[model samples]
Target: MELQQMRYVIAVAETNSFTRAAERCLVVQSALSHQIARLERELGARLFERTSRRVRLTPAGAAFLPAARQCLDAAERAAAEVAAAVGEVRGRLAVGLIPTVAAVDIPGALRDFRRRYPQVRVGLRVGASDDLVEQVKEGALDVAFLGLPTTARLTGVAARELARDRLVAVVAPDHPLAGGPSVSLGRLATEDFVDLPAGTAGRIQTDQAFAAAGLTREVAFEVTTADFMDRLVGQGLGIAMFPSASVHRLTGVAAVEVTDAPARVEYVIWSPVGRTPAAAAFLDLLDLPGPGGSAAHAARAALGTR
Candidate 1:
């Protein structure tokens, strides 16, 4: 069967609508339907069970989906390899970033990478640490910057420790604990907290720290962005626990060290098996030494460079 037919099937399975899949594939609906029909005739197996209301993959479709995706990925990698052989780093690199990551100068790194490899295309996605991690695992992203537990490991990926920073207590300047050198989780047990949602790495780390301390704080606001959470804490709505770097520059919020909190580690993680040339170049930039020069040096120390 043609590679186009495999693509059409995969798109239909992902979007669950022939019309939408056709739109995504940039073809007319009738053409896409005809191609799928031809593919099924060639294979003698129906790939989808369609109704006017919805589309669902058949048992056969489910069985074929993973292989279809692998085929597409392999084709793309082959093309990239040919370009790399010519000393060109030309391919799409999808990078994921967590909103609260502060150890890396991502914009600077991208700028330098683009300057060096003008032919390479880059795409960026920002999400929670867990979501970004999953995207890396699913091949939607080539690499991701994540805040993971010190000892936590993800299956099927290789990670490099970029930086280690302490989780701190964030409070409004006027809050009672603002002037403290450090605060204990036990002391904040009765205070209202502004926190990230349950599935995020930040929230998970905070929860574990509280559990370890035998204290539980009331969460008054669940914010998705670190900047918004800083504003919430500044408004005196509640306090929060966040990585120290995330709150270092807040105008009205004070980030006090959490004397008993666990340290959060930032990692640059990627699939070691299918790394693209662009990904390899970017990772090399992350290793270059310097403190504040080019993007390559912006977070160099975090990458364990001298």
Candidate 2:
């Protein structure tokens, strides 16, 4: 099947409406439909099941979607590689980060990257550190910012350490423990806590700290974003442990140093191989220190450019 047919199928699957897909593809409904039908006939499989109320991907379509996407991505990368050989970068840059990332100013960096390479399309996704790392490893994300426990190890990816910080106890201004000189993990464990979801890299650090301290704490609320954790702490619903760098930004919450608090390292992770030119450009903008030189050199090495 032609690449155009695959594009049309992807659009229809994503929008679930032929008319909307046509609009997205910038083509008429009939033309998009005709291409998909032609593709279906060639494959001898009905890609979509159409009904008056809705359109859904058939089993064949479900199976075909991922391969179609991979084909398009491979084709785009081929084009980008050709462009890069001539000292021009063109492609998509997909970046993922946890909400509590503090080492890099994402918006400022993106702004600069766009100014430097206007041909590259940029996309950002906010997710857990583990998920972001996995996405980078899978090549779904070109780069990711991760905050993991100081003891955590990264595998199957190339990474550069950005910053490190100890977590602080976050409590409402009126909280009984708010004015403390410093709190211990044991003391903090005595109170209810608001935390990132269990098992997440963000939460694992705190969980491990408490466990190592021979204490058990109750998590009164589990939320994804630090803002929600801060809000809950501001309401005196529960206390939270946040990276010290992030505490200053939280309103109505007082940060008390935790003597035995967990320390986290912020890292930027990318694929160990197959570095996209766009990804390389963005990493260069980060300008992280490396053994050889700037991260850009590493990116170039990954692209087989000595």
Candidate 3:
């Protein structure tokens, strides 16, 4: 009828004597008998056969024992799993990221997070800023990195500023423009450009930099993925604009600093605002050195970077 009743039935059956079962269960012999009798009546079946000197199971008792054991086992496993998660000891943590963050520091952070919480599963998803925001808001993702989108009119969600992903112009190394000196914002439009996708904040910043230089940008191509933009620049498809940290492998493209360029702010955002221990651990690790900065700022300086 209930776990307590099942336990009473099992105790009496195992000890095979009312007195011993009562002693083992820490109950009076009469109380133990009443508990077992209650269970038998609830199940509409007798679970034991009593003789003057001893007790033995009815066929029903033999059949029900394993099921009782199974219930106890399942209850124990459930409690353990819940405890592990609340203690930050284990469970799946779903993290979402905009393309740039995924390319920038997530790989190393993921490696370290796994080393610390090997029992916790880390699930990752990459998307544009809008999608990342939506994922966290709908509870589809636990947390994610979003390129700082500062539109005041934007809806709900909490954002934690992570780092600034400085935007820079990228050109094929062999291009005539690549041999030139460090350019200013004014010089940005001299060459035709590979554009960021229209309507995105990155694209707006790219366009404004050219505007500030008193020149108009000519779009040779428009792209969404910074990863692809870098690869394409290397192949000389076109000069691409992207976050400086997201552009790697300088073999074919030179990632040059653009003076007076607007830097994109990156943030780690969560849907519910309050963070899980695992997610908080990840955010804390990001502040460390190594991939977070140049050699001047070692691993210890990572989190200290504003």
TM-score of each: 0.83, 0.92, 0.59
lDDT of each: 0.80, 0.87, 0.67
**Candidate 2: tens digits of C-alpha lDDT, residues 224-287:** 9988888999999999998998777889999999887889999998888757778877776677
Instruction: State residue 155's C-alpha deviation in candidate 2, in Å.
Output: 2.9
Model 3 — which ten-residue stretch has the worst lDDT? 290-299
265 Cα displacement, candidate 2 (Å): 1.7
Global lDDT of model 3: 0.67
Which residue pairs in candidate 3 have backbone atoms (N, alpha carbon, C) closer than 3 angstroms, thus clashing?
A: 186-213, 287-302, 287-303, 288-302, 288-303, 289-299, 289-302
RMSD of each: 5.5, 3.1, 17.0
Each prediction's total of clashing residue pairs, residues at least 3 apart in sequence or on different chains, is 0, 0, 7
Candidates 1 and 3 compared by TM-score, better number = 1
Local lDDT at 9 for model 1: 99
Pairs that collide, model 1: none
Q: Which tens-of-lDDT digit does each residue in 17-92 have in candidate 3?
A: 8899889878898988998898888889888999998799999988887688657544543553454344434445
Segments of candidate 2 deviating more than 4 angstroms: 289-306
Candidate numbers, best lDDT first, in rank order: 2, 1, 3
lDDT of 2 at 94: 98
What is the C-alpha local distance difference test score of candidate 2? 0.87
On a 0 to 100 scale, what is the lDDT of residue 195 in model 1? 90
